[model samples]
Target: MSTIRWTEDHSRRSARWHSENHSPLPRRVVVADDRMRADHACRHAADGTALLWRGDFHNARQLLQAMGRRLDRRPPRPGSTPSESFDLHRRSRAHRAGILGKVLVLLEDDYTIALRRAPDVRLACQEAYGPPQGPVIVSLRELLGVIGARQWRVKGVDVPALDARIHPHYGVFSPVRGEYVDLVAHTPLPSTIEHRSVTTTAFDLGTGTGVLAAVLARRGVERVVATDISPRALACAKENIHRLALSGRIDVKGPCLFPEGRADLIVCNPPWLPARPTGPVEQGVYDPDSTMLNGFLTQLTAHLRPGGEGWLVLSDLAEHLGLRTRRQLLAAIHEAGLRVTDRVDTKPGHPRAQNTTDPLHAARSAEITSLWRLTSATWPPRASRHDPCAGAVRSALRRGPGSC
Candidate 1:
């Protein structure tokens, strides 16, 4: 809990600084009100100075928008390659967010804003920050994000596969993209493990909203265990599971990626991109160095019952962007002593996939989400170490109907 100090009313004052993204505390702070011009605010922000807003709440929002428009006037130059373009686009976005984050607001001990026209944000703040410790200072941009997340939590996202809505908690990734969920719903479940009489058991790894676990339970999996490495995600999954009345069928646990025992079926939808995330929410979108992906692959065989299968729901968008390659992915599976039995592919129907103006439109347009069925190789597998793709075989077992 870092504290930020500033002078007001000829007296020194300070408050705890809060940033979900862990941004550094401002070196300089000054009070600004309704009289502050957008250009002046931009100048202060460009100079790495923070503005403590004391004016009408709506007016502050307008000023923030004005500053954004000014920043947008000068866009980053386009790159020659898709990878370069992606890197430049990310830098531009980070720069924009940094400038806009200069606008700050203060909340009292109980999460109340003193400015006029400020809506009651106590509930939203409590949900995001837990019990309030004392007066806290946060960027106006982050505060707005918290408010928007509250609305989404209240309204919830409807999953066609589950025929229900999943309420995502603050910092938890929502299931806005339903293509992966559909693949899980439609995949054929293994009837029985080889040489053993066992009941149907499934595990959902890195379950964010528990959408896939819910889908598995609905598909008649006798017992389902959902694991996550985030406390917020675990709580969110438990709530959703309880709401769907599948609490009896599914057990939510963790701060761990994999639970204690093996399962007949293990499913994982790791983050698609192999890059570092900029914020908490992006954790679900990016996995630095493909750590989660490789972890799942390397340890997958140990957590599977004989004749059992592992379902890997992943997107080829990273490959299209040149961040990863099919050869490397196949090599990884081979080295892990796992063989790809089958794969189911689906094209994303997200608006960005069709948007021509997006910087990564080329990759998005060609993105293919797949559900890969994997199983352990026989003892003393024949594939040589140099032949990584020898055991990797991809037969299109199924193709999803249409865009989600």
Candidate 2:
């Protein structure tokens, strides 16, 4: 446990501190006042020195922004391919975050962050850092992020499919991306699952905001068991369920991937990328070695009733990034004793996909999000129903939001 040490000439002091990415503690630190220039700040940060800002809080923010602009102006790597450019871009952004993180801000023992233009972020801090025992130090960039997250908590993410708002707690992933949720929303329930009594149960693995679970309930599923390993996610899901008045219909639990007893339907939207998350907050976006994804596949058949269906929502961006292959995904499913019954593919409508200048735009534009319907491999694929009217409607949904 590395702690940040700051001792004034008059009083000795120390506080619980560590870099966001666990970078080595700077061997040299300088007290930066309002007079420090962006060039000088950039030089100090580039040299791996910490800058304890004693200046106005707003001014410190300006200096951090200046450093960001300087980093952005650096020349692009010459003759890099789109993939290489994408990789380089991620590295550059991370580097910038590290540099900006050196601008330190202090949190008073009373939970008041000592800086100008700083809002009362005590609730936000408590959510992320737990109750502050006493005074502590944090980066200005992170403080801003906390404030932004607080705003997000208040505003909540709107799920048009569910016709409700999912208030995301700090550290829980927000459902701003709706295409995948649409896949779950518009998906037709399994006939066996729907016809088996009035109460058909489904499990939402890694349920974040409970948006998917809520969508399932709205689509007429009677009982939904939502499970997650994140305490924050569990709380968020429960809160969202309560807000939608679906508390009785959906059960939220923590520290587990699957609930006991088989379900008629199981759905999961695991992290697409198979890399380690740099921080706790990144867990929703990156899964080291595709643990959750593979784990869900391998265990899905056992938890699914004989005629049940498993919906796996995934993206092919990893394939585009050369991280994983389509063949690998197919093999994982087969090894899990599951086979794809049908798939609904949709292109992302996010702004990044249309932004040609983005380093990963090519891959983003080429990305396809698929909702795979899975069942026991021993059981043959479901017989296709010959209904042109239904096929036309499903074809439109499969093509995505605007393809029709």
Which candidate number would show the highest TM-score if scored against the true structure? Answer: 1
How well does candidate 2 match the true structure in TM-score terms? 0.92
What TM-score goes with each of the models?
A: 0.94, 0.92
Prediction-by-prediction clash tally: 0, 0
**Local accuracy of candidate 2 as per-residue lDDT tens digits, 235-294:** 889888998999989999777998998998999999998877766578888998999999
lDDT of each: 0.88, 0.81
TM-score of 1: 0.94
RMSD (Cα, Å) for all candidates, in order, is 3.3, 3.1
Kindly report which residue stretches of model 2 are placed more than 4 angstroms away from their true locations once superposed.
9-11, 18-24, 75-86, 385-394, 397-404
Q: Clashes in model 1: which pairs? A: none
